[model samples]
Target: MTHRFVGVGALTDVPRVAVVIDVMRAFTVAAWAFSRGAERIVLASSEEEALALKAASPGWLALKDGPPAAGFDAVNSPGLMRSADLAGRTVVQKTTAGTVGALAVADAPLVLCASFVVAGATARFLRAEGREPVTFVVTGEDGRADEDLACAEYIGRRITDSDVEAGPYLRRARTSKAAGELADGVRRGYRGVDPDDVELCLEADRFDFVMAARREESLLVLRPLPRAAVDDGGEERRTARR
Candidate 1:
């Protein structure tokens, strides 16, 4: 199987099987949301659309980061997601990088969201499905999303059955430009931004299911793939959904 890494700007060139990486909290928040039993996540391409979707659905929750969008339920913080009572609730998510990247490649036949939290499971799912010629969309604008690039590399290594020790990648992510900005934002009391978000986003393999994206009316719906695990012989197995 061939694997290529591309930036968000390489939109028109995205292929049939693609994994979008947003390690500095977008996909990380998404992983946490799924872990907390959120029914599903509707990804909005923009803040306005996210707000409109949440407004239209009375019980839906709106999540994003940076400056507050009026009427947003919460900022896209993994800490908040971990503690949220999201059982059977839907989340409308808009983010600068993660959601935008996923929507940009929505036409791909197999589009999965990725971050450190679900990297292993994503790789396992891809391997089990025999997906070929995969493209990793780094999502961060330009080539500066170091954390995301690191996660992509980690996932690539996992897919290739290579030495997948995560120390180097995690260290790189912890010290990346995005991580520093996140720290500063927390210190400055950015609303809905949490001080622990960095560490939360770095928890590799925190969940054992892949986040698959499917197109819905005016939104991309994200749901966790059924639980996947590797057997002793390194073969993939599907287990009952958790």
Candidate 2:
């Protein structure tokens, strides 16, 4: 089957299935929060909406994403997700790209949440389904590089035909050099975050769960699996390290 990666706004000619990636923060944070036992996530279209949700729900909602200069409760950092006690709670995320990208493709026949953390599981899900055209929507900087592209390329390599060349996309996805430079320029930066997080995000098909995005009430909710439940095969057990 052919696997193509496109920007959020570039999404057209909707495919049967689509995988959305916002690895730097949005989708990565969502994956991390879910792995930490969050019951669910509510994606907001803007920071103001997310703040309102958090104010109404208090501990039930954790906020992320806002102007970098103006800081919010969370900053789309996957590292912060490891520190929060999200057991049985839900997160309200408002990212510039990730959340917007998800909303852009909400009309697709099938939309799945993906990132470096869940790349392996996502790939496994697509492979098991066999030859079906799949789209990996890389939510970029208004459509530029950060981490979303990297996560998409990684997943693309895993599920696409063996001959497909995902190198250009993969290269575009690696922001380590840029991330490192930023870390050095800033104090108390994310230098301590496990490098494995990046590598794990790049691994193809590590899990069996496919997260589907849907509108619940006025919010966006991501649901895992559809009708058929595939055995997790202990992948959940591996998440404890984070």
Candidate 3:
């Protein structure tokens, strides 16, 4: 297996497995929702599609960041998802970077979504599968999305170098420009923004499951690949606990 890291602009060039990283809360929210027992998440490339999906499914919830769209059930906040009772419910998510990036590479043989929260599990999944020509998609603008890049690099390192410490990467993510923007937004009382969400996003390997995406009809659906499928003798879990 080969690993390559690239920005969102290179998403179309991905050949096989693609892991999309959106550390500034998109994939972080998804990870929290899955941990809270969400059945599956449908990633929409646009707000309209997300609302439509929610409307079609009676109990499904629609979530996104930014100013509220009329039909969205809630803002895409990791803190809110952490406390949400999402048991057995499907979610429709549309985001600026993460979800969009995943869907853009939906044609790949396998697509996984990651943030700091699921970094280790994702790496374990990749190593277990041994898929060739894997690409890590940083879902931020090239050179401007430090948080996403940090997560991508961290995942790559975790897969190729067992002794790589997550400390430096997590620090980079916490002090990144995206984190600073979130801090400023929370300070100004920006809607759908919270400092606790940033704290949640920065927690490395918070989940032991991988969020894998599949294209179903017109939607890209994400569900957790449980620990049983990704673990290499529980090493990832043990390291995460430490």
Q: Specify the highest-lDDT model's number.
A: 3
Candidate 2 lDDT by residue in tens digits, 22-135: 766577667767767777888788777777787787675755553242324555666556677778887777877788888887766667788766666677666665546788
* Candidate 3 error regions (>4 Å): 12-14, 232-242
TM-score to native of every candidate shown: 0.90, 0.74, 0.92
Residue range 65-164, candidate 1, lDDT tens digits: 7756678877788877788888999999988888888888887877889999998888777776676788999987564688999999888888878457
lDDT per residue for candidate 3 within 1-242, as digits (tens), equals: 57778877765575578888899888999999998889999998888888888888899999988856688887888977788888999999998888878877888777889999999888887777676787888887763588888898889888877678889998888888888988898899888886697899999988889888877777788988778868753553322212
True-structure RMSD, every candidate = 3.6, 6.2, 4.6
Residue 134 displacement in candidate 3 (angstroms)? 1.5
Candidates in order have lDDT scores of 0.82, 0.64, 0.83
171 Cα displacement, candidate 2 (Å): 7.1
**Arranged by lDDT, best first:** 3, 1, 2
